[model samples]
Target: MIDKRLRVVLAEDSVVLRDGMVELLGARGCEVVAATGTAPELLAAVAAHRPDVAVVDIRMPPTHTDEGIRAAVDIRARTPEVGILVFSQHVETVWASRLLADGTAGVGYLLKERVARTSEFVDALRRVADGGTALDPAVVTQLLRGGQRHKVDALTPREYEVLELMAQGHSNRSIATLFAVSERAVEKHVAAVFAKFGLRATDTDNRRVKAVLTYLAESGS
Candidate 1:
C-alpha cells in the first residue's frame, strides 16, 4: 500500500481506460487532480495541479504517436519535482532512453499489459513519486540485449549484478535483502559500479542515475 496519499494527473486517450484509471487511483487513495485526453491538456493539467505524479500514455490526439512521451519530457524539463510514470502499451526503448537522458529521479517506464496487478501498478507509481525508479523487466531486458558488452566488461560479475538490480530501481538496502548480504556490501558494489563508470559525487547530478544512464547508453538502448 502507498504510504502517503498522492495527487495524480492522468493522460490516456481512451475514455474507457482513462475513466477506469481515475477510479482505480481513487480506490488506491490517490487523488486524480486532472484527467486529460491530449498531450497539451495533460501538460496544462500538470502545470495547473502540480500533481505528485503524472501517469502518461505514449500516444494521443493529433498524430497519435509520441505526443505523450514528448509532453512527459517537457514536464521533466519544466517541473523536475513532479514524478512521471510512462504507462504505455508499447516498449519504445528509444523513447525510454530519451525520457531518462538526464537520469534525474522520479521517473518510471512500464508496459501496460504487463502490469497485471493493481497493487503492482500503484507500487510502481509510489516508487516513482518517491524519487525512485520502477523500470519494467522487459524494458531492462531490451536495454541489456542492445548494450555493447565491451562497455560493461570492467564490472565484475557481482558488480554487474548490482548494476542490473540498480537499473531495475532497487535501493542498496533492497539489493542487499535480495542477495542476503549486508547493506554495506551492497554499497561497496554500488560504489564500485560508479567508479567503473567514471561517475563521481556531485551536488548537481545523481551518480546512481548517471550509472544507469551509462548502462543504458552503453547497451545501445
Candidate 2:
C-alpha cells in the first residue's frame, strides 16, 4: 500500500494525453502540481514546484526529438532529489542509456503504449518517487538482445528471467509475486546473478545497481 501522496510535474506535447495523465494521477492519489507541454516549461515547473517526481515525454515541442530526455538529464543534474520517469512511445536505446547513465535510483524509463494497466503505471511512478527503479520490460528486452551474450549465457534460464526482471527494476517481493515463488527463492536467484557477474561484497557497493550496470555494459548502449 502507498503511504503518502506523491507530487508530480507532467510534461507531454499532446494536450489530450497530458490532461489524461493529470486526471489519472489524481485518481491514483497523486497530486499533479504542474503540467506543461514543452521542455522549458517543464524545467521551470519542476523548479517552481519541486515535485516528488516528474513524468516527461521523450519528444516535445519544435524538434519533437530528445527534448524531454535532455530536460530529464538537466533535472537529474540540478535536483537529484526529484525522481524522473521518461514516458515515451519511442525507445531509443542511446537516449535511454543517457537517462540512466548516472544511476538507477529515482529513475525510470517506460514505453507509453506498454503501460496499458493503470495500476502498473501508478506502481512504477510510486516506485520511482520513493527512490526505486522502474524500467520498462521493452527496455530490458532491448538491452538483453543487444548486450553481450557470453556472461548472460552462463545464467540458467530461470536465473536469466530473474535478471531480466531485476534489470526492469522490480524488487524481490514483486518478482516473487510475478513468478509465484517464495521471496527466498527470488533472493537466491539474485545472489546467483551477482556471483556469476563476479561482483564483490562491499558495504559501500550497491549490488543491484552493479547488476544493472552489467546489463547496460553488455547492451553496449
Give every collision pair in model 1. Answer: 146-219, 147-219
lDDT of 1 at 50: 96
Residues 23-70 of candidate 2: C-alpha lDDT, one tens digit per residue: 989988999999999999999999999999999999998899989989
Q: How does candidate 1 fare on TM-score?
A: 0.73
Backbone clash count for every predicted candidate, in the order shown? 2, 1
lDDT scores for all predictions?
Answer: 0.84, 0.84
Worst 10 residues of 2 by lDDT: 141-150
TM-scores of the candidates are 0.73, 0.71
Best by TM-score: 1
